[model samples]
Target: MSSGNPTVFRTLNERVALTLLLEHGGLTRAELEQHTGLSKASAAEVLRRLENSGLARKAGLKPGNAGPAAQMWQLDGSAALVAGVDLTTTSIEVSVADLTGRVLGVHTTDATGDVRRLLGETLDAAGFGLDELDQVVVGVPGVVEADGRRVRQAVQLSGWSGLDDLPENVRLENDVNLVAIRELQEHEDSSFVLFWVGGGVGAGVVLDGGLWRGVTGRGGEVGSVIVPDPVTNGRRYGQDGGPLGALLGAEPLAALAEAHGL
Candidate 1:
């Protein structure tokens, strides 16, 4: 999908072209011109601009194709750095990836009552200093307010409120919401809901190709839906640690399993 159209030469044009190239891999100037339906000159100009910005580069010649082998332009996927952190009650996953969504390094550790220490160590292990990060996104298990300041109702996490003290520029999001975001962005599919039944059940909804966090950002709490609990005299929900984990904690699951069978 070459972006050959004039596209007004605004920031959006560059973004669109870059996205096209990244998604489709390499494309020759002529191919871009054809795919984007832009004049050859326009395509060349955009390609040049992207190359200058260190966002795109020539990736050798097109191979085994019919027409004359042309220089293929590809996204300079390693040019910039972005970090993503998935924090849950059970574990934390930290990764540094490029603009092309390629993970350069990753670290996963137990979420043992200290997310900050784990975050620092993971960043170090992933070979990314705080300075190198152009953007930081933290996805945690809780309801993230629109301002992204408050972590409301993170019952499992001990220091949920301390997230406000993180690097001021970092973006905070619900882990389930992040999953839905990744699903929608990576696949571009609409009308989907990601139900992550881990440590605790969580969900994120995507409608019409966009994330629907709702007015309060607590849109995904499928586990909270009431169900019968004879022992409690009220409705109950499965606990976190996923279904099995919810059904049986370190203490109860063992007893139930032993009593039932092997």
Candidate 2:
């Protein structure tokens, strides 16, 4: 049920319709209503708003069973563009995509001094200016605060903690969390755990079709778990070389594999 506020209801309906079009391609008014469970009048109003905003358009006409042809609507992918940046310890990868998630360009370069400068270079390589981007999603190799302001525990990637002059629309997310998001989207029915054993060790958990972000947004800091110390013969708390970290971390695991002649 829609709230009494017409503006809120209209905006919600527009979003629902836009999401459906983006996911399912072109759809007729009746089809939109059927899929969205919206009334005929509400669907028409939502479509009108979407077309007015230039976010959607009538793509073609669909032949109805008995009545006249019905107009088909689809999202205008070119209306907006977004960028995704994967910032790792050794390299930075950037991809420019449209509203419909079509990758327009991809660029990769070595990790450099200035984060903002690298972003600018990536945007230029993608044939777009910063002004043209609607949003920029940055995947960093550490825990990002829920507010998306700060990054911590990413010692390998310096100059990211105090990133200045970043664009207002930029978003910082943990690399593991981004991977978990991709996993969730690819497998909607299954919940699973994702382990990232790169320069650092981390875990991402998805439960009941949603990412389980615990308190303080550090739900997957499995590397920090304390366990028995090999040398001390006692328990020790360590993040980089803790028990879980020693077992699953890239460097330690690689060394172990070499020692085992595998």
Candidate 3:
């Protein structure tokens, strides 16, 4: 399957090479050719373009006893700065990282505080500034609705209106879906379900190599599930449930534990 366009092919080759270098830390010309299925000349051209773009650089020579010394190319970690935010009901945790996924700095603040301000503070701690951040990913415990503009059914992130006036580089996502992303590497299966249980319960459904966020972004509202439990009648979170975790969130769990004298 050829793109039949030289420019497109070149871009694809460069992206593949970058992913290889990022995953392997560094790779020689031959190693890249082997992994990317690119010819020696094509791999060399890709690496040259990556270097020119400042996305990659020659790290050093590979430890080999055969032939000429092969140059090991690595991703330029300083090429871009990115931020990840873990936003919860009470607290927000921000971490600034580079292209190679190295944590540059971290900052924590109350959820009620301004997230943009917290991001600025985190970037400052990383020896950078808000202007230098190329992108930011926020993981919120809620159903990202309205094309990711409005967060609805967030039983957790209540009262806070959120930083809706974010720049184009900022993105909001469901936290449990992000957690389910890790399962892809753990299993080769294209479909699996990851259950997030702690403060709340949610499902991360991966289908056909992607997280199914659903049309309305309520794909995995497991915490709202209802099941029957004959033992507990008055303690139900709502009507119509059968031993479900909807009534077993953090507060309810604590209440149940205290009632058990544990």
**Which prediction has the highest lDDT against the true structure?**
2
Q: Model 3: which ten-residue window has the lowest total lDDT?
A: 229-238
Compose the digit string of candidate 1's lDDT tens values, residues 1-262.
Answer: 9776555555766777887897788888888877778888878888999999999998999864576788899999878889988876667778888988898899887656555566777788888776678888888777778877667767777643357677755788888887788788776757987877666777888988888888767787666554433232232443322333354344444655666684
Q: Alpha carbon lDDT of residue 246, candidate 3?
A: 53
lDDT score of model 2?
0.81
TM-score of each: 0.78, 0.85, 0.86
The per-model lDDT (C-alpha) reads: 0.75, 0.81, 0.77
- The sequence of per-residue lDDT tens digits that candidate 2 reaches over residues 1-262 is 7459988777888888888898788899999999989989989988998898999999999998898999999989999999999898777789999998889999887766678887888789878887789999888877777867667567668744345347788888888888999888778867899988876778888988888878878888777676554432343344333566666666656656776687
Better of 1 and 3 by lDDT: 3
Name the weakest run of 10 consecutive residues (lDDT summed) in model 1: 232-241
Question: What is residue 208's positional error in candidate 2, in angstroms?
Answer: 4.2
